[model samples]
Structures are given as structure tokens and as C-alpha cells.
Target: MLLAYIDEIGQTGAFVSPTHARFSDSPAFGYGGFVIPAEAAREFGAYFNKQKRTLFKNEIPEGTDPNRWEKKGSDLLFARVSDDRPQNLRVFRSLISKLDALNGKLFYYAAEKPCGTPKETNTGPREFEAREENAMRETLNRLARHADSGKQQIMVMMDQINEKSRKQRLPVMYAHILGRATEHEDMRRIVEPPMHIDSSLSANIQFADWVCALVKRSIEYQLVPTSRYSWIPKETQLLRDKEIFTFESKLHLFHRAVDDICHSRILLEYRPVIDPLHTSTMNEENRKNLSESGKLHSVNKLEQPTNHAKAP
Candidate 1:
């Protein structure tokens, strides 16, 4: 069996550009982490704990439990893309080596979000839930494919959230996406809906969060070059803007790291996918039109159009 631990990256809230007064949070939203065999999880956890303590020995509190003490990946990996030096990124390269030894892969799935209207802050509760559902379902589909290729079954684990109500909600949609009705849910490749654990208690989930953070910034650098990465020099001039030679160097490093680690199996989705449930019930022609437009628009609970993204 495969054990897949995952976590969220980027905001679920609506965002346009970095300068937007109300709605600027992230250019995308997605899930990321790594997958390994069930037998190796505990051993990997031990190695992760040791690495964490060593890397953050000065930062962690003296008396805090090393296993329970947590660090946000954003804080650890911030300014990664803008910086030309690849020293900090060695952590990922080391992680990739460890996972590769265990026959695992770094995994992530994200969708470029729609640019929202000026002054819009949130995508509203309904729209937020819809995006969550969308990301989870697509993630399952991709993971299921991986399991199928291996002829192995997999279980998903994620960090627990403050709101326990979602525990009841995420699984129903997950079962549906797996082609099982909620009432008659049975597993084939993916064992069941994701099991949630307190991140402080699980080094695996903590590692997942860090991987998610790497994916978040790498994707923001990819999708929103003009907005989130405006600080990076755009022109290719060695004499001028020497500190910031080009975004290409950043992109090159990003690609090298991801390609070296993922081995072409990086699962980050390029577009915000329209959930199949939303379109499944539609008549054939409407679905055709929706596909042809190359735009994915979302609907709010009140049947109003909400956040949307252009397909790339």
C-alpha cells in the first residue's frame, strides 16, 4: 500500500493581482506533498524529525518538543524564486533523494485562479467550498491514476484543520469523484477519503506542508510573472539590473529542481478545472460550449457566476 501525505498551499480566497487592495492573497491554490510505501513511513518520519531539528536548531524553542514544534514553509522557503543562489533549495534536493530511495515521488496539484473584481476580498463561503471540492476531487483522480499504474492501493493523509465539519463534507465528494456514490462508497486504488492528523503530531504532514510551500511559490512564479514576481528584473541586461538578471534564471532553477525531483511526474495542474459534477448534468451541447470557450467559470450557491480562470 502507498501512503500519501498532503497539505494545502496558497489561499482559497479570491485574488487578482499583488497590488489589489482587497483580494490579493495568492495567484493560485493547490495541494502538495509526497507519497511513499506504508512500510517506510515511520522510518521516513524519524529522518524528517532529525533533519528538522538540525535545520532549525537555532530557531526552535529550547524546551519545545521537536516533533510537535512546527514551522510554516513560507517562512522557511520565502524569497526562493527571486534569489539566484540555490543553496537553500538543497533541502528539497536532499528530500528528493530520500524519497527516491523509498520509491516515492513529490506530488502537487494546483489551478491558476481567476482574477477577481476590484475590491473583492473573499470568494464567499460557498465559492471557497467549491474550490476546495474542486482541488480535492482532481487530486484524487491524479493519485488514483498513479496507484493504478503500480497495481497498488493508496491511502491519503492530511493535516487536521480547526473546522471539523469539513471532515464530513470532503469525503462525500471524494467518493463521488472515485465513481462511487456516497452511500455505496467502496475503495479500489485509493482506500478512502483522506484521514486527518494534527500537523504538530505528524512529521509527515509537516514535511508535506513544506513541499506544498515550494510548489506554491514555484507556481506563482510560473503563472503570475507580472504580478507576484514584479520585483524580479524583467529585462535581460548584465550591465544594468545585475542583481536581477532575469526571471528566466529563476524559471530555469525552478524547472531543474522540479524536474530533477519529480522526474517528470510533477502533478501541478495548469488550469482551474471545472468540476465534472457541475457539468455532468448539463446537456451535451452546453458541455461542449463550456469546453470550447477555454474558460472555466465557477457558480455560487445562488446560481451566480463567481471566480473563473482562463485555461492555458
Candidate 2:
């Protein structure tokens, strides 16, 4: 069996730019972390717990139980994104090595937000039952593929959320876990319903938070040069690290393991491009579908939104 520990890596809501006043926090939103053998999970969790205590003793909160207390991944990344100092870098690199030793690898799948203005469809009320349902299905399809390739059952675990928010996502979960697959492979490879574990109880879950934080921050740094974090060699007060990659650009290198684990293996769902001003890249099919007058392509029969709908 394969154990996949994952957490939300980025915001799923509207993001016009890094500097957008109302919606500027993240350029992407999806899930990420690491996957390892089931038998190795306990060992990895123990290692993670030791590292968290050793590296973040001061930030572990005053009154909380050490075992139950958790360090937020965003906070850890904020403290360690600087690439000049090697201490923190060594720590993160060591963690990476630990995971690698277990045959685990980093993995992430994200939806690149439509850059520029984001607006609701001007047509009737709404076309889909849930707005981000496609994104969720895309995530599951990727997971299913990952599990199938390894020929092992994968059990996905994510950090717990609030009751109200959790309740809202239940429908999406039910559709994927209990519902059948249409057009795509049924997620029988994945042993769902996914477990939602508290980060405090599971060191692996906490480590997942860190992995996801790195992914989120790295993407932000790439999308916005002005982003305060750096995977490059530089002087930042909080965390200067000896470094993971020595090149000027580490996104390609960093994503190498990531793609092998899942990215390159993905069969993407067709999504209608929404860039009204045409500032982003478009594939050949999308370009060919464009009208002679250069307007956005109309949704054809095969291209209809219902084509991407979940199984009934």
C-alpha cells in the first residue's frame, strides 16, 4: 500500500496578480506533498516529529502539548525561504533526503489561475453545480493515476478544516469517492473516502504542510519576482540557506521529481480558456477554435461545460 500525505498548497479563489489589492495572495491553488510506502509512514512520522521539535522548539507555542502542538507550514517557509544561510537549508534538505531514502517523492498539481480580471460568467445563473468541482476531479484523476502506476492502493490524507467548510466539500468528496467515473478512469486505485487527519496528531501530516508550503512559495516567487521569498542565493535576514539548487532558476530542477511523480503523468481535463484580454498562452486547438474576428471560441457540442460534468 502507498501512503500519500497531502495538504492544500495554494488559494483556489480569484487571483488577478501578486499585487492585486483584493485578490493577490497566490497565483495557483491545488494540493501537494509527498507519497511513501505504507510501512515506512510511521518511521517518517517519527523523524518528522523529532525534526519539528529540534528545529522549531521556540515556535511550538507556549501552553499546547508538544505532541499535539504543530508549526504552520507557511510560517516555517517564511523562516526558511532565504537561500544564503545553510543551516535551515541543511534542515530542509535533510528532510528531503529522509523522504528520498524512503523512496518517497515530492508531488503537486495546481490550477493556474486565469491571469488578469476574473469575472463570473455573464450567461444565465451558473453552469456548474459547484464552481471548483472540475479542479477537485482533476486532482483526484491525478491521484488515481499515481496510485495505478505504482500498482498500489493509495490512501490520501489532508489536514482537517472547519465543520462548515468541511460540510461544503462533502458533496464533492461523495461524487468522487462513491460516484462512478465518466470519460476518466474510476478512482478505484485510490482507497477513498480520504482520511482527514489533524496535523497535531500526525507528524507526516505536519511535514506535508511544509512540503506544500514550499511548493506554494516557490510558485509565488516564480510568478512574481517581487515575492519576498527566494530559492536562489541571496541575503535574507530570516533564513539564508546553503541551498538546494545552485542554478539561477530552480523551478525546472525542483519540479523534476515532482513531474516524474505525477505532473508529467497527468491526463488533463479540458477547460475553456477565460482570458478575455488574451495575455496567457493557448494551445493549438484553442487557437484554431478562435473565430476569424478573433473572439473567444464558442463552446461547441463536445466543448460544452456539461462534457466535464461529474458522473450521475
Alpha carbon lDDT at 220, candidate 1? 58
lDDT of 1 by residue, 1-312 (tens): 999898986877887776678676676676778888899999888888888887777888888898899878777666633465343355545665676677766677666566775334445777777777777766666666567667888899988976765666676656565674343222468887888889999999998998787666656545554534332222112112122111111111112222211212111222112122345467778767766753223221213332432111
Q: lDDT tens string, model 2, 137-183? A: 65566666667667878888888888887787767776776665554
Number of backbone collisions per candidate:
0, 6
Clashing pairs in 1: none
Candidate 1 lDDT score at position 311: 12
lDDT of 1 at 7: 91
